[model samples]
Target: MSITVQDMRKGPEGYAWSRFGLPEYTDWMDESLSWKQTCYIGDWSFLWQHRFTGPDALQLISDYTVNNFETFEIGQSKHAIHTNKDGKVIHEGVLTKFGEEDYMVHGRGGYWLSFNLDRGNYNAKVSQEDWFMFQVSGPNAIKVLQALTDSEKLLEAKYMHAVPVTIAGHDVYALRQGMSGEVGFELQGPKEFSEEVYQAVLDAGKPHGIRKMGGRIAMINHLEASYPTIATDYIPAIFDADMADYMDFFLSSMPSFAQPAYIAGSFDGQEPSDYYRSPIELGWAKVVTTQRRGYLGADALAAEKARPHRVLRTLVWHADDVADIQNSLLREGEHYDFMEMPRDQRGYMWADRVEINGQLVGTTTSRGYSYFFRKMLSLATVDVDHAEIGTEVTVVWGAPGHRQKSVRAMVQSAPYKQDRSRGDLHQSTAP
Candidate 1:
């Protein structure tokens, strides 16, 4: 028998440095709260990295990226997206330009970029780099960071800008960015300096109530911040007939665990190809400027942009229904798949089918608990007509042919967590 997507059910099952680096540095709940109450530090060294160089590097990037490239500059970063000809997102990640023709990417975008660079008529060469990433985020993040580097220069560090700094007497690249949607910085440097910078941040952050964040609570930041991630939110676009050979090689090269994808939702797409999403569907339509430098699928995306489609939104589950899941666990054998704290499903998209008035209109991704909001929430995509705030809908919270229960949820604005990261450094920040 051929392999199937359900095989992804066998995720990395263990509690150690295996997936969650610290397991629970100080407990998932407390760590989840550190970013809201004070500050939190996270290690993301294991996130893949890729570098590209050559005269055609920028051209290669421009051809594929949907974001504006005219303003992209050195030391600046972008939430880069890669999509198939159908305009559905293939992969995306954080991309930074080191020069006009030099670029570095942090995430799975490497694999797709490499594949294209090898076949396209470009002089660019791709190389995987070993970089260590350490994040310091929260209301007190600036203070802790200022204590370590040039406060005046760091003060100019705006959102999404990468700056150079020295920490623990080691030169490091400090990127003023955060997935937590808080005032924070993601510090990166050579792999050898990981320990040095990590310890220094922990020590300097002591006065700010810095807690070491782990894998369990790390992704919670995405929900509050509204940052969509690959795999967990959408399947990688590699199953199209045109990409058959590429998919075969890509699957063979990836780890056993990374091969299978866990698909959940009411869409009932025939295969991964049918599940691919577009920029408009993901609520990234704003970045799809058609009257400019052409990128991959620009014409097709422009055509689709003019049409109506489902858009991404946030859902606040009903308090009563959320409580019933737990209440059911106590009375029966197994009820409602058992909602877990921090996040419900592990390493897989907790996608559920979304509906409005008995009509299947959308799907949900990234369901989890937010210690800051004290509510269970999820990021979802629904028809543009039903994408308004305060709109009521139903979310089927279990796989088909298995135990399932429908929960009531209301459409809410995304980045559900208030935007306070842009607040002044000296102000008392509250979100």
Candidate 2:
């Protein structure tokens, strides 16, 4: 494994190591809670970075992804998804426009860039960079950022917006985005400057009670926010055979972690299943625009719109029932049926096979405890009838011995959090 200097810098500070260099610092949940109840700093450096630039950059990006890049003003950002020819999601990330032709894509998967390069019609330059991402979140996050730079403008930057600033004499990109469902900002800068930037934020935030958080706390907040991550729920589409040979070659040249795997594809020797999802099924319909000319997967997605098969909905598992399953297994002296914490398998979990009442309908992607709401929540793709709010349904929990066990789950709105921090940060009303 190739470890960058950035890895050494963050390891002592408590970050997890995956196949990729620096995973999120989930090991530091205790420290996060102690400090986040007041203030906390988290390492988010593992997020991959892809830069697209050239005369036709915007046009190429607009044609490649589902979101309308034409609508995004310079210095603004939007969440977007890239679907396959079959209309299944390959990658999802935040697209930030830095200049007329400059854009950065931040997410776990990098095969999307290779897919664009292989399409090869547009004259655009694409490259990947090594950068470290750190986020300071909590009630005191703004105060910490305000003291780091002379740019008073950073203090007023709206949520989901970004501004270039200098921190501890190093150039840093700061975005007012929070995964914790709390008021916060994320800092991205050169890997060489990781320690300095982290120290600067800590120093500035100490007076306001800042504490360093680990990956566990960050994952807890991610569950609360219901944020979708690539490779965790859905695999990128480059692994599909429909792509040209050159595209496959380009993907092979990428780093191991960056390469697309056949986790959810039929090439893995598993039968094709409904674990795949279109952008519309993932609550990203707003980003799909047919008003513009055709883009990748446009035809397939259009057909899907005319005859949609399933819709996305949130599931609230019965607390008592879930607890009872755990208790029963303990009484039988058998291992627990499902993992107590959240898990991300590389392949998609087949939704239809894991249904209740012998009717295969939807697949569940993310499941976790909503600490803020005091309930267990899951994100699932279900048929229209069961997609309504307050609908009762059953979800197969996990495998019986080597297989997943089934459990009863209830249907609810897409977002289980009554008070979404993303919306809370933008509203005129105070929390």
Candidate 3:
């Protein structure tokens, strides 16, 4: 039997975080609020890192990604996306340029890049690196970092740009990139200085009300901000027969926690390939550049962009209908799949089928409850015609072959929370 992704679902189950450093430092509800009201410090050292160095490093990156790197400057970072020949994203991550020839990638994209580097005739050499990455985000995030370093220099680090700063006398780079869709800075440095840098931020953040964010509610931020993550929103496009060799290498080299990916909920894709999504479908068309060609999936992306069938949007589930499903658990013989609070505790995508007039028109993924908004929101890729704001749809709740319920929903613009990732730091002050 072929080793499918479903076959790799080994135990260590409930929210599988044996490798994730911190599951919860405080209550998840309070931590979730920190990024919106106060501030939060999240440890992202679990993200895999890769270093590429050579004269041809830039060429290698430009040839593979959909991004145009002609203006990518040193000390700047990009949400780099790697796609297959079909324009479906394989892996995406934060790629930063430290020097003209020095590049670092933090995420699964490194594996794909390194694999290609070995196969292609390029002078660039790839090696893994050990680094510590922590993100401080919220309206009050600037105050915490300002207290630790030169406020002027800290403010100089524009969004997606990195600036060198010292914390507790330890040299580190502060990158202004908010994953929580708020004013935030990512503190990155060598592994040795991780403890001191983290402690310094904790101490500095005390007065400003910084909470140590946990893994449980971390993805709630992604849902609110419309950041589509791999395995959660769309499966990687590397499981086909042609990519079997690469998949083998990936499974052998990666940790077990990073390997397994299984599908659930009501979006019944016939095959694994049906779950693959292009950049255009995922609301990342802005990131795809076509000024020049030769990149993987360049032609496919151009065609798809011109006549996109579906677009990503946010869905506001009807409160009463959601309550009806939950109420079923109390007074029914066969009840719907129990909905987890905040978000699904399991790491599966938990995708649900979306429809209009009883016709399947889209799919919903990344469902979560935002205490800040007091509403249930989810990301959906619906037909372009029905994707307009206020379009009414039905989200089929529960997995296939189970008692399901039709929950009414409305199509809304993505990033349900107003985006403040690029808020001016000078004006942002802690209360």
Candidate 4:
């Protein structure tokens, strides 16, 4: 009854969830370079999608989310987060407005739509649907996409935008969003056409040097891109009553083999406290605008605008120090401290409580190897003082063994990788 990649698809290449799909090499730099030098196709159909329609759909959404959707144009997408009364994140997703009364929301978690429906104050209806989503990335991604679609206007589509186009004679939704920290596109289409679209990209990319990438390489890219993932890189928001029920369902439904997976945060089967975050802590303050009228969690978020507790910062671990710890265990018969990767194909790690000088200063969430930066990096929520760049601190890694070791780590900017790709996407010249 648990969720498995096989539950999503099957093949000799297996599903993108296959551990074998990851690069055979361990170094992320080489793997990422393979994509940058050529191209990489990723299977992203695991993301959940929901469709909303009806006369009251706009009103229903406008009143519940922090972002203003009143002026959203058709064929455009906007990112928004739904929070509980206490301002804890419920779900984050891209809102795609197809028309005045039709829209689709895509996100990692599935319960947000259900929670909105359960509230019963809105007149619109929500229903979940199955769709296959794929991400084509690297230098030549746009070329491959352009070959498949006949729409000449696609070349003009800007970043963070979406356009309806025909691909291989099938209608597909192509978004200019990418998680690989590269110039790319996300192609969403019907579940039945999943393999066709996947093959089309592979075929068109053959001349351009496209390789299939797995979750391991994708984790490195996410780290470099500074994109945060729920249930792996951050604590799951457990503030709302219906959201609590959804979390229970997710945990209970997980397959027996996946039981050891880490579930973030302390829900404890009760309403969450004020210790949770507003949009600011999640590094999403840009989307929070108070210029418009009232919305859900607006007042609370407005109050937090004046006084924000913790800011999101990046931690870069010294390569020599990390290597020494590992070598100590292998060469000197000493056990090295274990640091968890952000998204392990087998399972995930819980957020580690961080302390500095005997004071509870922060919590370290997303941690991964940055092949491009050639160092280990992590995303943390820390107090104002500890959040400053160049601040040094100690982080406790690994589960409690016979002996637990704390390693020295330093705070840096959130995005360890320079966002050259984002800039390149907007440039007139080809990447």
Candidate 5:
């Protein structure tokens, strides 16, 4: 029997929790604040790693991605975006250039690259590997990393640049990339050394008050940093009929957490494409290069960039309005679906409709409670006319076929938190 994404969207609860193998060793609220006040190491081993090699490796990547790779040098990485023919983002991830013709891509974007590899007559050879990817992030991230390695590479590494370092007698590549909107490093190494390296870093970070971020609050940084995630933020563009074969392979090969396409909430689109978003709508227009031509969706992206309808913004939900929904549970009649604190434990693309005077204007995703800010924040893709700062909007929060609530929200910057990931870590923001 063949299965489709619709087959999986059978319930409002969506799929089970995404497994990262680590539960909260401390309070989730404290863990939420760790990346801001102190530091945290979150496990991202489940991220797909695909390596491409040979003369046509860069060509294969450039042909399908929207990034300008003309100056992508060794030891440097770029946040690459892959889109379908319609310019809708299929997947995005970190693409690192290792050698002259050697490159590796992390996240679902690799699958898209692999899917297109055979379609073209490129000389690239593709290989898949399991890697232990850990992200150590926060204001004190540098101090914690400095304790683990004696190499001065940590001090010399530039933003999005990978430096070779030895930790626990194992060669690990540390990439100076921050997803937490703070100083951070993504450590990558062979899976065999996962336990040793992870433990060693934990021990080294003990003095810096490092927190073990579990699956619960693991994505709070992403929400605050405006990093849109696949499946959770937007449905991949693989559901189209042309990509049926690739979709089947993706479903059969990828893990449960990585495979689900279940969606819920108030933004009722008639079809899957209604939920599709262009890079411009996701606040990634800066990464799209008009200089690069012939990529999968170059023409469509160029067109969208010229006339973008929606822009990304942060929506701050009204406390009293949200409280009323929860308060309804204590009252009578029907109650709105409970708003999960921090974030929904069940990983669903919970999109709510944004409106102004009963007129649809935008859609909100990645809604969560930021303990640090003491407010409920969500990422919204609003019509450009209504996306300005302080623009008041109403968010209809509830799953389909359930009692909904009208929650007032105000538009703010896309990244609710100030981005300091690319800032000088040597200056030390740690107290």
Candidate 6:
């Protein structure tokens, strides 16, 4: 069942109230700082999850996703990518392996998997499960986990590994992962313990300046940390004919899934595939294995890999030009697109056109003001030629049909934040 306690109906401005009760908790400033100096906790129960269990579960997932499951083991998780036969990414998410035939996936990745299982003669049974996930992250996140967990093993869990932790007299699974590119644990379990665990964690985190992070400020990590999101960057694979029934079920299940994408980019292509992105284009190049025998889209991905295309990078907006847009609100005239702090609540893709030398080159998405960095940053996918460090590009800001102002930007390497996610908590168990 969906978390419908609060009226989730989108506000006039395209904002939805998160399960956190309020839209904005504390302020964007303190919440933004919580991910750096202190810690922040946010509820991510909104994400859809599907559990697969059966004799053919592994094989069913192997044929649907791009992850190499030959070496997959219990307690291990991977950022699995699902793609069409043409190698275009359909959806991607975190896939966790529990038993040999048991798996849990978080995100829209289940769409492709469900589509395949329904059409194919697989013995796997797919059951959707609701989980209340709380993302507790920052430099001091482990501090709270240390106090709650009885086992030192939970505190020392490896990256992407899930360990059981006792919090508020309940055993919840804490996945050692990072959304802010820092030391963090995503504590998730039954919804009954959600309220109890949430309070326990908040009380435990009080000394560390633990702040309640709302949905608005929670997305800023993706900008600086370079985590590409669904709908915000690439369109899901719903246009294909085979997915007609799935779209019907998808839209009927969640009416908000029908949000349209706004494509305002310089890559003027006509086909639907033109709007699609490959696994490699989203900085997941390492996950695609050409050396392996075969998987869905493997051959096509290999072919696409042999060609030139756009890659993910960070674009730092010009200081004066960004200020000019903000200062416009003080004046009496129409202003450049208002850069909302932390995130943009608008539904559309909001992809801004990027150009160099008056020639269209790339597209930028996930535009936001990162208070952590004290600068306006956006994640962009530009042609490999324009992805060089310090390459200058101009971003066309504002909705279409409006006289847009040029915001100068420079290309920088993604993962602008120093990665502390894989750091060791205690002494190594290695010999």
TM-score of each: 0.92, 0.81, 0.95, 0.83, 0.96, 0.90
User: What TM-score does prediction 1 earn?
Assistant: 0.92
In lDDT terms, how accurate is model 5? 0.86
Encode model 3's per-residue lDDT on 232-314: one tens digit a residue. 89988887887887887788776665554666788777667778899999999989988877899999998988899999999
RMSD (CA, Å), candidate 5 to true, equals 1.9
Ranking, TM-score, top scorer first: 5, 3, 1, 6, 4, 2
CA lDDT of each prediction against the hidden true structure: 0.78, 0.63, 0.86, 0.65, 0.86, 0.76
Q: Which lDDT tens digits does candidate 2 get at residues 1-431? A: 22322332233233223322234443444443533365678887877788888898777777677776556787787786777667778778788888988988887334565566656788888788878888877766666777788546665677678888999899888887867666777898779989999999888987877877644445455545556555434444544456555345555655544433323111122322233568877767777876654677888887777677777777888887778756766675554454554333322331323265867667776566655556777777788766777777877654323434456788887655443335443231123
Off by over 4 Å in 4: 1-29, 108-110, 239-277, 331-334, 337-343, 424-431
Q: Candidate 4 residues 157-275, lDDT tens each?
A: 76777888887778998887767766777888789988888888889888887777755667667666777665445444553454556565555534434321233322111122323
Better of 1 and 2 by TM-score: 1
Q: Give per-residue lDDT, candidate 1, residue 210.
A: 95
Residue pairs clashing in model 1 are none
Evaluate model 3: give its TM-score.
0.95
Model 1 lDDT-worst window of ten: 10-19
Give me the runs in candidate 2 sitting further than 4 Å from their true place.
1-39, 108-110, 207-209, 244-273, 303-307, 333-338, 342-356, 400-404, 419-431
- Model 3 lDDT-worst window of ten: 10-19
Please list the residue runs of candidate 1 whose C-alpha ends up more than 4 Å from where it truly belongs after superposition: 1-22, 265-267, 426-431
Off by over 4 Å in 6: 1-22, 260-274, 306-308, 427-431
Give the lDDT of residue 20 in candidate 5.
52
lDDT of 6 at 154: 63
User: Could you tell me the TM-score of candidate 4?
Assistant: 0.83
As for TM-score, the candidate ahead, 2 or 3, is 3
